[model samples]
Target: MNNKKENIRLLVSLGIAGVMVAGILFIVGRFSSSISKNAMYDPPSPLLPNSPFPEGVSLGAKILVTADKTADKEAGVQAFASNDFATAVTKFQSSLQSNRNDPESLIYLNNAKIAKSQVLKVAVIAPIGLTLNEAKELLRGVAQAQDEVNNSGGIKGLPLAIQIASVDKFDKIKELDDQFVKDSSLVAVVGFGRDEKIYNDKGLVRISPGSPTTQSRQDQTQSGQTRYVFYASPDRDNFTQAIAEYIVKKERRTNVAICLDSAQAERSQAIKKQYADFIAKAGGKVTDTECNLSAQNFRASDFITKAITDGAEALLLNPRPDKIDAAIDVARENKGRLALFGSQQMYGEKLLKFGQGDVKGIVLPVPWHQNANNNAGGNNSFGDKAIKLWGGQVSPRTAIAYDAMQVIIAGLKEGITRQSLQKALSNPNFSATGATGKIQFSPSGQRQGGVFLVKVEPCESSQSCSSSTGYNFVLVQ
Candidate 1:
């Protein structure tokens, strides 16, 4: 009888302890709820069904409910706010007990998943026959920007990865084209504006970092259109028109002459016709056209002699800066008494240095640079980050490269599949500090911004030339 009584007493004590423990747990749970509410700035009211998830779905809830909670919720929130997606993802995952249906957990989890898959792979294929040092530098800038973004906590915590494949300029055309076709992961292509047939693939989209010929080609579906290509730079038509207008409007000259070196006269003729129209719209005239650019003794004097003989008051040419030396020789031979105008091809520092007397009055349309203005439009935070991580040299292609990586990262965060990257690139809605300007695209694969007109100035006697206003280019307002 004494043993039975002792067993009963033990059972009674155990029941009382259990009740007391339950009471204490209930009070602690309420206290935790209050702290969570205060921390999140929660109001004492229920949310509407259409509103954002309740406070219960916040990181605080996950932290308080977890057995090994350790103030991870606040850290996760901070990470997310700073675009440090990777860190936020780690913290959120740590605070979750069962993240399956938790809205906040799911949001972070989805971002992490997309980021993991968004290891964007790109391949650059320049025209095999052209010597494109500028294009190479631009593409390199883009690659370096990707590296920087990847290192800085990545997009939504996914790392950025890029690969480049360059073809020798002397390689066979067929072999070069074959190489581009074989690589399947190539999300987009750059520096192939000269060859429409190379990038005419449905699965891939091409981004032209340089100016393609303005002359229309049969490969494209329509005039001034790139069927399978997205020109990060302005289309040849817009660029040429802008150049022609600058000569007439800014330089105060008329009677323009066109010097054509392209193979087919079709594109040149089209450009001439369009340029004449734009000039007329802007109130100007075209005096003549020169079909041959490789005439014997094509000296500055020869062209000027022809221009003076033809009553050419203003010359609109397309010779690159490297070729300006020969043109300058021709001009000096002719006594340097002629007004000249050229395309963006003649706006480099070399042209300003070597052809100062020959190209004094020359006008050309070029991309505007912010650095010319106390570095206002410089690659601010994104650009600085890219330069610091990559190297000391930040080229013009830096902005687009960073923007491209951001696009890839964003798509990955939003669960954009590989199949849709091409489409997304066709018309990405996000705004980013572009290398050129506010970088955005249109549905037809053209950059949706205007070009700028720049003037070349005489620097010194055969030294590297600088801009008159240090690239202080303004819109045609």
Candidate 2:
């Protein structure tokens, strides 16, 4: 079968799929009016002012205080000027009771509340019951990024803290996201797009740093100043295409075994179809099977046995990290006859620790490799700093989380308001250098760093191998 060389890139473009989410953003009045009591509409809230006694609150003057019959609105402004943001928030809320549309009160209320908080709060909703390394790496990347931001004075001078919502099933996403939306201080969130609740909740901006989906919530980005969702790759389609390219262009595996975790079967079914489509187009045969699942006993060995019976020349394993062992054991038993392959889910330290040295060359497709840029150790490079800061190599999952934080930080720099952050993230021109390299978003909220097919290798290897990410990235079109 003669495959078109350009089809590889085309598969990526056509299958650059993501599920867009929709949301709502609530904003107050328009910008400032000419020659009014205030020149700027939204001013800064003091970071816990030690002393009070300022006449007015202004950015240019940094002081503007006025009064009326119910000076709650005016008292709030005075407290805001004095850096007593806690008092300012009290008065602003009292002011809102009298007139909810009070632009001045609404603006300072949000500001005073944010200023009074101990840290800038954000949420990360990740599924639990996955492997420890999977959860650990994701959390570590986020924590490291938070440390970097807080060390540098944080966003709007507030330190950062991530509230992790760990769920067991994909269906658990919405329930937790709804909980985060209730907290007004929680401006943005990062997690799985498969969390369907994120699709329903229109109050907080959500982002899936790694999970991929078939639909997108791009409409949420258009919402003026409320909630929205954004994508950051590992979309099932991209991974399938990447693997397909590798099978057709590199290994020439004619009949490949495609297996899945019964627990993850429903979630992974669509991806299996995508794999089938891509490989068939490339003229490679796909032999598919579903895993054996029990409430207490689910083994990939049974799945592998089925693949061998079907006469598969290669194996593609898609499972949560915990189930990867079963597949590796089977692939190793068959040894030279059956090749092993996987998706981004397989890119972690656990693969090395658990692969039993049997998966030395199992191939996987990932979005970022430490050596993707071919830099030894640039001070600003994402991978190098992570290794230096954390004292371990950075995985693509960690890099993606780091990049997600970088994206939010970039959006924070654009402006502190929720609406500003959404627009900044969705801005077609806005691109940032993250630990994963240059990151830009598509119109549908997909990150620009495309997928790369990486071959699994030992955690420690020779100079001939690039083991930084515990694997070597094979060049493919």
Q: Best candidate per lDDT, number?
A: 2
Residue 90, candidate 1: how far off, in angstroms? 30
Best by TM-score: 2
Clashes of each: 5, 18
Candidate 1's error at 229, in angstroms? 2.1
Candidate 2 regions off by >4 Å? Answer: 1-118, 126-129, 168-172, 193-201, 215-227, 264-266, 288-306, 459-477
Per-residue lDDT of model 1, residues 1-477, tens digit only: 999999999999999999999999999999987554222221111211122322222211222123222455557656654556688778767754433212234333333333435344454443212433333445445555454555577545544433333343434434544554444434444445344565553334556665445432233436443345655666666777787777777767666666654444666576678778877777778766353455554444455667667776666666543355555554455453556656665544445445555555556665544243225544555445444544333434444444444445444444333335454565457444555556666655566666666554444556432244223112233
| Alpha-carbon RMSD, candidate 1 | 21.2
* lDDT (CA) per prediction: 0.50, 0.62
